[model samples]
Target chain A: MKKSLLFLVVTVFILSMVLSACGSGNTNGSNEGKANETATNQPNADKPKDKVTINLVAFAQPHEQKMYTQLIKKYQEKYPHVKVNYITTPPADYATKLQAMIAGGQTPDVFYASPENVSFMVDTDQLLDLTPYIEKSDIFNVDNVWQKGISKYTRDGKTYALPKDVGPFAYVYNKSLFEKAGIPTPDPKKPLTWDEYISIAKKLTLDDKGNNPESPDFNPKKIKQYGAGFWWHEPAVWGNGADYINEDGTKVTIDDPKFIESLQFVADLRNKHHVVPSSEDESSMGGYTRWLNGTVAMFPMGPWDTAAFWDLKFDYDLMPWPSNNGTWGTWLGSQGFGVSAKTKNPQEAFDLAAFLSVDPDIQREAMTMGLQVPNLIDMAKNDYLNMTDKKPVSKQVFLDVIETNGHDWAFEKTYDREWYDLFNSSVTQVWDGKKTPEAFVKELQPKMQELVDKSIEKKKKAQAQK
Target chain B: MQLTEKKKEMWIAYLFILPLLLQFALFTVGPMIFSGIMSFTDWNIVQKASFVGFDNYKNLFQDEKFWKSLYNTVYYMIGIPVGLILAMLLAIGLNRPIKGSKAFRVIFYMPAVCSLAAVAILWQWLLNKDYGLINYALSWFGIEGPSWLGNETWIKAGLIIMMVWKGVGASSIFYLAGLQNVPKSLYEAAEIDGAGKFGMFRHITFPLLTPMTFFLVITGLIGGFQLFVEVVIMASNGGDGPNNSAVTLVVYMFQKAFNYYEMGYASAMAWVLGIIMFIITFIQFKFQDKWVHE
Candidate 1:
């Protein structure tokens, strides 16, 4: 009896293990089966009697996901024969997960494309060139989209994706803090020069002893509040009329005297002027939290963060980026939807992408959610910036920056991820005050130039093959 | 008939083990060999892979970031000894028949069982420079705390402290089990020989616990070399800490693979790390017999 019992227990254990393995294997098999089924259904999709399924994936926050689901439902109603499988991945894991899926040959029919990933996707032939689709469609017009948003997804004069949103960096200031310090609120119409901005920042900054930074007895060590912070170097550099790369993008000009001076001015905000929090302080609390807590007077943020900032207890408003040489500037960030090259239904995928990007109703819904600035010029102005109930009180500043001062970074066009990794890693030292900007730029310029040159060569080689 | 029954049972056993063996072969062993081959190429996931001979390895040798990451990984191993000592001491203290020892054991082991991401976030708050619990406590004694996560000089030390806090409880449980296995008669014998508490621990209890020590040290070193999650959580903006102080070998490899899409370079890094781990573990096994009690 005991011997038989042992055998029975052993058999049960083995059976369970085998059953679990088969369970996982079955799921993978089913996925592959579905892919094959989709492929077969594509050709028959043109027939009025046949049904087709298209897979679409995106990374979105909870609110944004709900909006996307609603939009997809509307699209399905219009195209009753089409079945859509919408997948949403969280932003943190989206890139890695999408890359794995594409590499494994289960590419989504449509997916989100950002400036960072577009070049890689194009080079690998993962994205379908949408130039022909746009040219043929009566509803889709490339000129209707903002030029800034369109340029981000274009390569070699061919558009690959339609812009879903355009995020222009603008100055966000705590109005309550400025009022408390007895300073006049900054005018959105007039851009503050560097000295004027610094003087105001000095007044807003306060030490534990309630002394301003300009006071002779001000204690930097016991600072209770900071005046301002610029999140990225681009705003400071561009505001000072210095570009990191020359206009032609042939070489890095980070070593330009104007750029170096801008860097020093920013560094002095912490070290010498004592009007801004040190890097350590900023990392600990974050600029947004500090602004919400009324510890910071001014911070630069994109439109995407406006929704989150809406809940702040203190009064706040947006303004155009401050000017240095009568030219205000900030970086423009754009995200859009692209059709996959491996997609079985290119027409359906393009339809979905175009609908998500250019449709006025969907863009208005996104603006209402405070998710993004509308990518369409007319919609962004008439529907969003001119909206009566907008909370920020200066929502038009975002549109203004996009229309006048916004530009893409030099590396965005030619350099890939490797170049960015090199630049970001080296620049952190300068940000942390471990190295002077002059020394850092001088030492890193050659390395950055080499990466740019290598990228150009690789692009030429790929073009030759094509 | 008896021989047939024996053969049938043998077949059943193999059948039961087959699933587990197959899983191990498919997931673990398959990836290992594939990655080994991939390490010799110049492949980004999207691009076509081309055979580049030893170029990936050659580039790794010249990579300054690789060297810095290796240094950071080794530096992180300092937590092992610190963790082991604290665990052993706690285990010894708790081994005594005392009030509420069971509850204390559970309380201490809580951190080990808690979700790693949650624990890391908790530690970030605790180590915050301005209004954190540690600084708050320090202020009462008229001492200001240094910026734990912000300053490069203290970031590694801060990470080590967190590791010890999280690991000590689980490690002490292992020591406690080892302590239980030790014969009570040895302590009686030592007492009869007029041995004091220190003498008894040093002579009788300590020798018996060497096996557990050996186990923990070897495993700890392996775990130490792959430190990624805690640093990633603490430094969420950039996975690399201020001035790249907290970038370990595994984290760098992850950035290379996922962020840069350099599969070939990442694979080469993984193999290099694997070989280093093998050598170290081999050396440990060779030397363990001298100190580890049977």
Candidate 2:
């Protein structure tokens, strides 16, 4: 009886200890809340510029990492008093890792922000408002940078980040493949219509028996080469004068007939036309390698692919994406740097962000490395267009899309992208010939709309909490 | 009381275990209680939490994705039984006094020790629809192998195959040890009672191995329920698979908590999973007496 009593007492004591531990956790959470209140109350705690070490976090490829290392050396040379620490992780883990850091209260002073997460960051107060900083700084000119890049991270007249690079997509065709097929190369300035594009693709696609998809004896099972590889459906939808959302962002318009038509056309290329590779075939030899080996005649190119494409064995050049409505559309992507709202050394962090973002010398070096199209409009039009030492001789195609028709990706407007992700996963059925594009879009509209509505509601709640 | 020798020894034993007790109370018990409380509130880690009171749980019931994930998780448990049977057969086979049996054991055990990420990648190549070795072999029999990873209907089965292949080695080792524990006298007695090899295995060997089988089943079910890394590495798009067919409960919970920051909902999911696991294990333990021999 005494031993059991002792055990009960010990159990009670341990239970009390557990309760106290939870109580301490609550206290710690409230303490973090207090810290955030103070951080915002004193937005700029610019202590005497005595050697402050501010850290920046991003994800980059090896070459991009080397580029940043060189850029940091130059920046430190210019401002020797401020020390910058750059942290990089693999690209796939960057977003999750950055958010985890913020949650852990180890938020980096400066970090890369993509369009997809900028809204979420803003809703969470993770980003510092850059409008005041931009107005005070003379070196970082908003007028010089492309509006397409700058506008993505701006919300409610407040700029949260500055554009580091603006990636414009261009249609690149293998010149050797065209020559071997005894076909004339496409004009750089003009885009082919959907009908013309399909006919040309049929001619370019070849079987082991040397018959094109257009021939009676053509065998898709033994196809030696594919004509085109188009992974993204957004471009085709936009080119056909339809969009994922309406202009006011009040409604999802993906169920529009134009969107279904465009989707069907892309799907039919693989399922019906036998020009584009099927999902199974694409997996066997990835689209990137297929393009590299000259098995695929045409594929989309981004500014980021420039450096890698330079070493291709066969000749290649850029053309406009095929248009259904006399205007081509593709995504213009941007990655930017933002100062953390909780950062103590706001001034130094902002300076580092600006130097990395809009500095002419840095942008020029990045352009030389084929890392990006210049964030500066004038430089992209003149300097980037004149760099004829690259394989993609028609550089104007990239500029034309950035300057004219490229739209921000669909998910950029929302705080979260569950809606877009759901749509992408579900739409595979349409692409695989299991369902018609029209039926799939009709069935998916309400579901996608519901998720979008939920995200918007979440954003409103976040704003109200703030 | 202090003068009592037994009481003094008990106090010393308590003192020795005090550090471990404190650690458990502080970390494990504390966090579990906190998450239980958190499940009742709406908390985005960065934002202030507000009490929602079972709203998250109610939402979970209506969520199609939750149901899909749960179904997928239970579907993956099919590998456990399949793995156990294969492992038992392998253990029995390797128990023979044959040339290179030890080498064969090592060869089979290789997959269990290999890194999951590397193994998943190798399986991806082997399961590829067009150029895979599996499909190439099927072609010899004039049969076309279905797209294993690509089609929604086949993806779960594909994952089950990979999981079974990876798990059989470790399970067989446990069964092998259990087989050694079975007295050779029992088999000899069965044989003397006019039993053939199959009869001896059925009556003596299989019945004797029930305890090990029970232990393996419980652990395997628990492990199978938490399937995440293999699915993440194997599935093409961040573990969603074709039409989210490969998304298990734990993966969905992870996506909710980390990717979407729905901590309260994810906490509710974790609790539901915990409850399910507890119920299953409790039932298994309660029924073990029916099949398990002393």
Alpha-carbon error at A350 in model 1, in Å? 0.9
Candidate 1 segments whose C-alpha is farther than 4 A from its true place: A1-49, A246-250, A450-466, B1-17
| TM-score values for chain B across all models | 0.94, 0.92
For residues B118-204, write the lDDT of model 2, one tens digit per residue.
999998888888888988998999999878888888889888999999999999999999999999888788878899988888888
Residue-level lDDT tens digits of model 1 in B1-294: 799789777877786677778789879998999899999986777666778899889989988789999999999899999999999999998998999999999999999999998999999998888867987898999998888888788888888989999999999999999999999999999899999999998998889999999999999999998988998888634567776788899998988887766788899999999999999999999998888888
lDDT per residue as tens, model 2, A1-466: 7667777877777677778777876774567556555645664557433556778999998987998888888888878767788999999789778877787787899999987878778888989998899889866678888887878889888999988788888889999999998889999888899999999999999999889999999999999888898557987898899999877565788889999999998899899999998876776668888898888999999988988998899999999999898898999888899899988789878988998898888789888988888988888888988888875899888888788878988888776777887888787798789999989999999988988887787788777888
What local lDDT score does residue B167 receive in model 1, on the 0 to 100 scale? 98
Query: Which candidate tops lDDT?
Result: 2
Total clashes in model 1, counting residue pairs 3 or more apart in sequence or in different chains: 0
> Model 1, A431-453: lDDT tens per residue?
66778989988988887787677
Best by TM-score: 1
Name the regions of candidate 2 deviating beyond 4 angstroms: A1-48, B1-27
